[model samples]
Target: MPVPGGSGREFNYPDVGAGRDDVSPAGYRSLEMVRELGTGDQIFDAASRRLFGWQMHRAAGIRLARSTPPPAPGVDVRLEWGVGPIRASAWCRVVDVVDEPDRRGFAYGTLAGHPESGEETFLVERDTDARVTARITAFSRPARWYTRLAGPLGRLVQRRITQRYLDGIADDQW
Candidate 1:
């Protein structure tokens, strides 16, 4: 189904399980941070928990419009922006989750009716220095006519949001 005020087009998952390559073909944004999180497993566990708990999105000023009890691949989720009458919603699906020895994270793909078309990955990794890192990579293009018209403004907004997510990660207590 289309998002509340979206284009009403049926969303497609043509690139299911595409993972990081899904954003490789195009110019995308990536942000990373490294810090002390005790050990590799501890960092992975904390970051993964924070991700599935929706704290990252919340820190970026997005709230849960709708959610499932526990986050997992293929789960449907909705996020809301702004407050009061100036609110908007975006629908998405958890495309995949990662749990490797040196890396852990999840990716979510935007539905057809959402403002963007692409996937975003949230990853936590342990570097050779034994420091834990959190990374966010996104590849997207405007999905709506209005967003396309906004062009540069849309990109600027995305950058700001990316920064917000980074700040959220840094400020996150978990």
Candidate 2:
């Protein structure tokens, strides 16, 4: 797909978010790239001890630490694509933890995980507000020239898979 303004850069700052002219522009791109390749919205309720977001693409069931509060290390995560035996491993952390900006109802955490593919993250922006939306934009590059031919095909598959997964994640769930 062509980027707006004909930049042709797959990573669109505003489109995927994480692009901040104010701070960490490069870092934001890197983080956004990770999210682009996997799940980008996550929620972990320490009290509940359940890691949600696995039902969607790049989502995984992880075991969290009760003593360390929510989003602690050693949280096992499994992310996958295409129904194969292919999977990746990683963990989540509340990198930019903060309270609800609008002061509504819920708190949120941006959990980052890697399924061994490279790196991935789930970006759940709002918890206090019921209006929320999430999408998985996992990315990959085929090996060898012949394999490159399948890039378009791969993107098609990814889009279809992500859309279906998004159907399960509701506005409030994000």
Candidate 3:
């Protein structure tokens, strides 16, 4: 489906796949978070699955309102936040996918209606020592008034959610 208020062919932000790059665009907040999930290929495989299957977002306390299973380039997803009657929704389209022997991940750029204009990537990697890690990279700026108003609080929330993503993946229960 076409993103609302968006061309459906372009992202709301100019640096469309910047999250996968070493440097983020100017005038945007750049964030990079890394967490050691554990060791072994089992952890790496499970973490990758959760991230791509939308389970990581759910574990982060965000609702996956709509999304295509097993994210691929051009797939659109809608995520919702808030409690009870009050909710805020954000739209995003997958921009890239990485599926290599030692790494797995995907990057998505925000669409219209998203509170932030940018891209975010989630990745799981395994090193030769069998060490597994989860990483999140993003570059964004508030696109809506509320997000701008929230300021630092918005960044705090983002960090908390990112922590949840790592913690959830680390949990072997799933």
Best by lDDT: 3
**Candidate 1 backbone collisions, by pair:** none
Q: What is the lDDT, from 0 to 100, of the residue 126 in candidate 3?
A: 93
lDDT for 49 in candidate 3 is: 82
**Each model's Cα RMSD:** 4.4, 12.3, 2.7
Candidate number of the best TM-score:
3
On residues 52-163, what C-alpha lDDT tens digit does candidate 1 reach at each position? 6777788899988443534567666777898788999888877688778787778877876688776777777787776776777777777889889988899888878876
Ranking by TM-score, best first?
A: 3, 1, 2
- In order of lDDT, best first, we have 3, 1, 2
Q: How many backbone clashes does candidate 1 have?
A: 0
CA lDDT of every candidate: 0.69, 0.30, 0.83
**Tens-place lDDT digits, model 2, residues 1-174:** 332332132221222322112123232222221111222224323111121423333232222233334332223322233335653332322222223332111111122322112123333333334333342333233323543566566556445544544443332242
Expressed as tens digits, the lDDT of each residue in 1-174 for candidate 3 is 464543364467878777777588999998888999888877888888888888888877788855356788878787887889998777789889999988999998998778899988889999999899988888889988999999999999888888887777676653
Clashes of each: 0, 10, 0
Off by over 4 Å in 3: 1-10, 65-67
lDDT of 2 at 102: 20
